[model samples]
Target: MLRFENVSKVYDDGFQAVKSISFEIQQGEFLVLIGPSGSGKTTTMKMINRMEPHTSGTIYIDGKDNNTYNASELRRSIGYVIQQIGLFPHYTIEKNIAIVPQLKGWNPKEIKARVDELLELVGLNPEVFANRYPKELSGGQQQRIGIARALASNPDIILMDEPFSALDPITRDQLQGELITLHKKLNKTIVFVTHDMDEALKMGDRIAIMKDGKLLQLDTPEKLLHEPAHGFVEEFIGKHRIIQNPELMPVIDIMSETVVTSLPQRSPEKALALIRQRKITNLIVVDEENKLLGIVSAYDVIKQLNDIQTIDEVLLPAEPFLFDSATAKDAIIMMDESPYGMIPVVDERKKVVGLVTRGSLLSAMSSQWTDSEVAE
Candidate 1:
């Protein structure tokens, strides 16, 4: 629930780092700010915590002006994790994590419990690591401590400024996955800054692309991948990326929108005739509102044609279905689990919008290899 309205930042020396960018982040949304060097992504993130104050325009946090709160109080209320793993080397792990809650006047017992809970939350054993200093832990472990410290006060928002950029590649990847899992578990509003596009795509719910201190586009990863709003944005996200990585392609993009459907109340005779006419094995059955009911197979219809009154009697559960937001990778993984080798793609309201069939999945996957061959 953060909103930035025409926000700009100018330094004393006269250079502007952020140029009147306007955007909003919804509650529990993981928004990633990304761009090349001098693109103002990092500056935009820092402005959220007032690490670097803007020269003009307004930044509202939960509908209140960020400037309305005391600077220290505001900063303390927002969790911040940086690339350097800024843990006090002398402080024990427990003490490092207790800093924020202590400042907020939490009692020692509550602080100790919070410290232990957070250590476990970040995948560390408090019993083993609580008394240890930062020097005793590995880089990844230290980063976890940094995260634990940031969450010590249980802030509603967390600002991660390339927090995993300094780690080894393997560790960076692991931490990225862990952060994604953590975000889903905690459901906190996260504003992450990264220069890596792949990282941005993999981790961000919505990505904000910036250039020359201006906000170019702020959209979902799927939208950003398929529909680059600007020439620079398209160039920044390589045109070949989607072709090379089918996982990046949203299912809605490649799915067949012309799904064969029938009413669940239809008699088995009519359902069988419809399937035969369409030369299909299964038919997606929906209610009056077009909400997905289930699928009825032709074999089942014919076998039970006389026994069943309505097609709903033989309708199969719509398991392993994909939502419109799912990517090709999701459909691919769930394909084997689908009874009829097809998955219905539904909207947020569970209304069937499209269908991803085995053939469509193969075609989408084949395109990647074809593109690679052409490139070669």
Candidate 2:
């Protein structure tokens, strides 16, 4: 864990890169520092590893003053990654990753194992890439190598400064997802810096917005979007404002629990009778445990009524469904993209729990809008 107390950084020419900023990073938390250029976000992060020394105030790492430890020793204990990667050109990928471990006086066998383990952890094949030079890999591959290097020592905290900014969109998205999974698996406290709001929202457990060498607001992504503290915060969160609203609305809030369903082993006559009784077009097909199998429609049953004896023969492909914990936005998107009129909501074991239809989405949105208008 890391904590900053009234931290400020000033240059010799009288320029203050950072104001007195205070924050505590809990263990296993992904904290994103975001702002426009020159907002002191990077400066604040650099101060943690002593990359940029604080001119005033104190920084503590694991309850000890950062200044008390030798700078090299402190930095070696903390993993640092930058946008440029900074991998040594002449070093093989394995050597690049083993720099810290080697410095820590690890034996050759231990260092080799650690290098292989880190390479695999970042989705790289150690056998193929262990001897490859940095130039032999793609930009995304190089960035992954940089991450492997950061994790080589298994540090408790990792500092990332725009590590994925240079890659293409698809690659960047992949790396972002990998980083999230990696964070959960490693459980390391990460301080990430980015100027992109979408990245901050998707990756950060909490976002800290800064501007002009001062901290503006720090809150969870939902709160930051719905309840911005200032006009600058609102402007900074521009365009994706809708994400703040619908993400909070759970699928259960608007789903219809009276879904008509048929058993997979049922005959076509039985399924057709239920469909006609319910006056619905389609029925979700489930097994004995109510776990989703597929879907059956009245038209299919009628077509196969004479040809086949069971509903399984007339079953139609099921559309992609949603989990009970999914948000309204997720349901809306799934409905918009799919041809099915309704999406079955499932539990952890894929048992049908409820159904979310287009009508339900519209009703939910209409209610939300009306409430907002009345509040205004």
Candidate 3:
């Protein structure tokens, strides 16, 4: 829906903040701009609606040069959200949200309804918040109101500049998930800016990594992680490369380094709860010495619930089944046959090594496929 054609930005002082960069953003694609502090991502984004004019070349919104359209007309059709939110302190949330719709000459009834709908979409109770002023709301709530105001115009594209960067980590993650869900519903073309890698991976349809005044690499998260374009790209990704290890077989190789939660020998109820809580169907059986003895399955718990009040009845017989050095392909097949979502990785001694899951294995396989295509 948008295109940048060999665009460059040079300041009066002769600093080139954005070089001759070019890329296409498909309709409804969540394109993320990721890089360090001095990178040109913000500059590139501002040029879209001529917030900052390009020094040379063109920015085409739907195949027409941005310069050809009047600034007011162009901006009215686009949604914008920033890290600071920039809401009017004196205006009520409803009034703030109603700004664009009213400017667009929407009917009074329509504007009111839209305010309610957008507030609800952002998890705010319209009845309570519609009359509240910006100062009365929390920072996150104000940010949401800013987004509601952006969507009020029903724009075809949205420009978000570090919208969630000011929030706490947990709140940031929660909002990221909320944005991902909203994108599926709204399907508006989005240009997002962030330095957080996981956010780029989770939300970006394609990530465009930038350096000082230049575009570095534009690729899917899987491709970016598995097949970095250069040493710079590799260094940019950093320890996140550990997440894309295709050769690491079995779950044990990549399980969280923190101590595993253990199931008490006599707690059948705890075992059953753990199965659902961990989203895993199997529980590792261990003794007082912190040694792996056996494993328990949910089926085993349900089957002998009447005869046993404890996990001893469901505990593995003998050494139990061992999953040794299986490739991702082998693991997928084994998981398909067993009731467990994944089997524990073990060595020749049948000792616990690591863990893998059906979902994680599938993610690995996808990275392998995309990386192969990237190689070719």
Candidate 4:
């Protein structure tokens, strides 16, 4: 819902903070701007709310020029969170969260209800935290309060400037997970800025890598890892480190494309024959288009062999499948968490493309470690 066109910002000292950069952010998408300290990622974000005006070009929010809106109005319509957890020390948590609604002229009753609702939404008990001051809360709790404050008015977009950077690693990880859950629930377009690659990869739908005030590469995390745009992109991604770590490798890299399948309408006898021929215990059931239907194990088919005529009659629901875009680490964790022996891997359309088994993971990990040791 937001678009930037040839946007640039030059300081009065003749320094260009942001070179002409253009990108679009889709509605409900999490886009991350990542770069080093002098890369101007923050400057680009500030320009959106007019906190820092661009020296040239235009920014549009929801199809209207951002400049056309009054500065105060534009900012209030967009939620903002910063690294410092900017909560007013003098104000109680309830008062801190109610700032925006109060300024919007909400009545006392509405404001009070909103404050309580927001506190609960952010995982804080209204009764316990409502009267507490900012200092009374831990850093992570304070950060949640800051987020609640930002969402006080239910803005359609949120801008987060390294919001979790100051917390300890464990707290930062928790907040990141919470933010992802919140984004799914709220469906708000979020533009997050961070210098940490891991955070960008975990949280962003698309990552924008910047350097020297210029956009370098913008792509999904999968593409960014497998098909970097240039030498700079490759080096910046820490290719050697990724190659050495199987966890960083995408599932597609090691998944077996030779998946055995049975049509949902196939007879149980036929499906069992296919499974035995393939020397496998289970067969993935699919439709005419090869889209995954579910799975049918030999044990299930045998149990119902005399009673059931078709595989459909004995088909069991498929275990949770992984997308091709997911990392090997994701697959490993998912497999460990479940009782399934194998997980089907699918493309964006949920069509079965490959399969991942415990054997494949062990082989990939072993090969990667060997390669790393050889390189060393």
Taking every candidate in turn, the Cα RMSD to the unseen true structure, in Å, is 14.8, 12.0, 9.9, 13.6
**Candidate 1, which segments miss by more than 4 Å at Cα?**
240-376
Candidate 4 Cα deviation (angstroms), residue 62? 0.9
Cα lDDT over the full model 4: 0.84
What residue pairs clash in candidate 3, if any at all?
251-355, 251-356, 252-354, 252-355
Tens-place lDDT per residue, model 1, 91-162, is 999999999999999999999999999999987888999999999988988999999888889999999999
Per-residue lDDT tens digits of candidate 4, residues 1-376? 9999999999999999999999999999999999888999999999999999999999999899999999998898889999998899999999999988888889999999999998998888899999999999999899999999999999999999999999865457557767887898899999999988778877889999999889999998767876678677776766433333656788888788999987888888888778767777678898988888898876668668999879898787787789899988888788644334578999888899999874345444333434765587
Q: Estimate each model's TM-score.
A: 0.69, 0.69, 0.70, 0.69
Give Cα-based local distance difference scores for all models: 0.85, 0.84, 0.76, 0.84
Evaluated at residue 221, the lDDT of candidate 2 is 76
Tens-digit per-residue lDDT, 255-300, candidate 3? 4333244644567777767666665555677666545676676656
Clashes of each: 0, 0, 4, 0
Error of 2 at 372 (Å): 13
| CA error at residue 376 for candidate 4, angstroms | 8.9
